[model samples]
Target: MKKLALAVVVTMASSLCAMAASDVTKSPPPAPYEQVSKLVKLPDFLPGMGALFVDPATLPAGPFLAYDHGGKLVSTIYMLPIKDLNPDKRFDNLAAPGGNVDHVDVYYNAGHPGVPEPHVHVVLWHVPAADEARVAK
Candidate 1:
């Protein structure tokens, strides 16, 4: 069962990486931050989550690209609203916009700007756990 899940995740990652191939050479890949910010209200930088870029239309299920201070792609985040996680609902095939995730972290968030509803943040970290401190406030 775990192997099946791993296979599925790998396939999705590969697909996303291919879709991003044109931009991958650019550090962080999801630039220029200003253009992305125009589409969504992205902060200068988000502690722990790093700088983010997401299309408002894809909210809640965002493959929100996260980047480090030096513009390194660090993680891909998904903000899943608590109300939507019930048995009837499933967020399947959620893409990891930044490929090669080193690990994943899921945590509850009561609410915040841009995402005001209570939600869970599914963070797919591209860096090793030890390197995550790069985004610490």
Candidate 2:
């Protein structure tokens, strides 16, 4: 039910955004949520909820879709700049201090064309920070 609603909202928003002023280029498609999810082996998720869309080319990282058991989007994952995060461990190194801290999980997103710098994004489960930044706009 939640996915359906979200899809509906996305469809409507896309339609409206399509009617933008002639000066603006239409928005690119959202990030390849499923592909990225598989790439990182998201620690948590719900069926069909993986179909999230955030263009990776512009943003440094992600709001990788995380769903609660009910299939509603509960959080996001995105990469911070490598120079800032300065992580010493690999992206998939779940042992890192930030990996699972504060309801968030971190993962490596290397060699991905969308990422400008090699860095990690976090699966911020139930974290208002991620949601506050992108969603609820």
Candidate 3:
């Protein structure tokens, strides 16, 4: 059962990564941005999180895609609630949809409107450390 679940996750990640990569050059990022936003209610951009999108069906444990102002894919994020993290609860092999990750930043949030739970933002940055300045609004 565990193996089957893992396989499903891996397959979803691969599909998302391929879609994001291929559609990165599109006018408005139809795959990750337009398509995802149509499925979920997200703002155009978040100060520290960048342009964000998530599959609504995968809520709470989202492999959320973050893009820069110019519509460039920057990172993949997972909002893991503090209550959900324990020895018994393991989230392994989370995907980075933007291919190679340059760095990772994990931080705490005290609950926001979209995700109203005390959770940690597990950010997998695709751009170099310096290039992240693009999303610093």
Candidate 4:
């Protein structure tokens, strides 16, 4: 009958629309895995007046390095996409040779050397082995 055919057509159209809508609402693919390189030493004059340095050899899709203003080698830092990280989490505590990290700063290159491609420079500070216990606490 005509009514039966109309009902069938409506059901088919609704189903198709539902399928299309579901596709649109589907979650996007997971972000690519970021490569992390080995910890490298920083140059004396990198930035902040010998306060920061990055080891060229340990670049992980980067040009990141460790930094220490006091020249004690306290912690290390690297460049990573801001979108790929948790804002509340500390990268040093997540990954680094020295567990005690003072802080981290993310900077976009402003005519600065060795930035833009790697997109990040990680600053790490050194914690004395003897002071590890005190620092940890």
Ranking according to TM-score, highest score first: 1, 3, 2, 4
lDDT of 2 by residue, 40-132 (tens): 444333342333434344355554444444344455556666676655734343222112334765676564544557776666655355443
Give the clashing pairs for model 3. none
Candidate 3 similarity to native, TM-score: 0.73
Better by lDDT, candidate 4 or 3: 3
1-137 per-residue lDDT for model 1 (tens digits): 99999999999999987776546423445543322455546667878877777655687568777778887778878899999989999988987656677999999999877778999998998889999998886
* Candidate number of the best lDDT: 3
TM-score of each: 0.74, 0.35, 0.73, 0.34
What is the total number of backbone clashes in candidate 2? 8
Q: Relative to the unseen true structure, what is the C-alpha lDDT of residue 84 in candidate 2, on a scale of 0 to 100?
A: 60
Task: Provide C-alpha RMSD values for all models, in order.
Answer: 8.7, 14.3, 8.3, 17.3
Clashes of each: 0, 8, 0, 17
Q: Candidate 3: list runs displaced more than 4 Å.
A: 1-21, 24-42
Counting only residues 3 or more apart in sequence or on different chains, how many pairs clash (N, Cα, C under 3 Å) in candidate 1?
A: 0
lDDT of 3 at 72: 81
The number of clashing residue pairs in model 4 is 17
**In candidate 3, what are the lDDT values of residues 1-137, reduced to their tens digit?**
99999999999999998776666432354543443445546557878778777766677778887888888888888999999899889998886656788899999999876678899999988889998897889
